[model samples]
Target: MAGLFANDSEQIDRRTSRSICDAVGERLQQSLRPEPRLPTHLEQLLDELKQRDRDSH
Candidate 1:
């Protein structure tokens, strides 16, 4: 009797692998595009603190 399962590593080609990777990457990029930008008030406060520290040192 022959076994029903076999290894499929030999059947995959470079082109197919690259195509799958590219599709998954595109989906991820689309999902991340709408993320909100950072808050400007927090950014300005951090910059001011850094400048004060630099002047003291």
Candidate 2:
């Protein structure tokens, strides 16, 4: 009987651990996901900067 209970407890622990890992993995993926392209104004600013750098050199 004790052995059975121990097995059940271990199984529950494994499931809980897996659930926590999955949740963490999902959150990490969302945080690491690539953002959409920069806004048009930002893009333009970057382009201007690049042009200025090239001209300066």
Candidate 3:
């Protein structure tokens, strides 16, 4: 009976630690995530380049 409780305690501790690590990893990912789109000035430059390409064609 004592051995069973010890095993259960270890499992619970492992699960708790894993959960905490997972939460911290998720928050770090959110904070470190890059923007998905270019800035406005870069977008305008790209658009102008695309127009020039189309005109050349």
Candidate 4:
């Protein structure tokens, strides 16, 4: 029953579909950044954790 599973494969060209997806993924990767810099207020909290670790040792 290949016909049951297969329908309208010819509606979209495979190469064009692949290129569109690749371009979209590339644009998203370029626009996204990881871990923005922490604000100054958080610095003290980070320092406290460091001190706690030091004391634990």
Candidate 5:
């Protein structure tokens, strides 16, 4: 039945948003010229994650 296989709207929206974020992140990683240190990259990733958390609320 259509009901059994239908995707929830909210679920679809979340998946789309996640996929976009991942694609953008990948593009950024590929475009960066200087290879940053491990700690620097980790800190930036943490900051981006924190910003996303704040934006969601």
Candidate 6:
């Protein structure tokens, strides 16, 4: 499996990759709208599921 992935020269440096990812993530966050709030009934159902989960544990 030697050389199966990016060779050393072809690989991106960690710092550069992190900065690039951060910029992209920031742009994505800016472009997306907040999701609509859940309906009351769905919220109640979610609360019930959470309670059942805690009870089981």
Measured over all alpha carbons after superposition, the RMSD of each candidate to the real structure, in angstroms, is 6.0, 6.1, 6.2, 4.3, 16.9, 7.7
The models' CA-based lDDT, in order, is 0.84, 0.90, 0.89, 0.85, 0.84, 0.92
Where does candidate 2 stray beyond 4 Å? 1-20
TM-scores of all candidate predictions against the true structure? 0.49, 0.49, 0.48, 0.44, 0.37, 0.45
lDDT of residue 57 for candidate 1: 100
Clashing pairs in 6: none
3 versus 6: better TM-score goes to: 3
Candidate 1 global TM-score: 0.49
Q: TM-score rank, highest first?
A: 1, 2, 3, 6, 4, 5
Expressed as tens digits, the lDDT of each residue in 1-57 for candidate 2 is 667777554566778889999999999999999989999999999999999999999
Q: What residue pairs clash in candidate 5, if any at all?
A: none
Better of 1 and 3 by lDDT: 3
Tell me which residue pairs clash in candidate 1. Answer: none
> By TM-score, how accurate is candidate 6?
0.45
Instruction: Give the runs in model 4 whose Cα sits over 4 Å from its true position.
Output: 1-10, 35-49, 52-57
Q: 1-56 in candidate 3: lDDT tens per residue? A: 67776765456677888999999999999999997999999999999999999999
Tell me the tens digit of each residue's lDDT in model 6 across 1-57. Answer: 677665787778899999999999999998896998999999999999999999999
Report the poorest 10 consecutive residues by lDDT, candidate 4. 3-12
Best by lDDT: 6
lDDT of 5 by residue, 1-57 (tens): 777547675345768889999999999988986876579788999999999999999
Give the lDDT of residue 7 in candidate 4: 77
Kindly report the root-mean-square deviation of model 2 from the true structure over all alpha carbons: 6.1
Model 3 ranges with Cα > 4 A deviation: 1-12, 39-41, 44-57
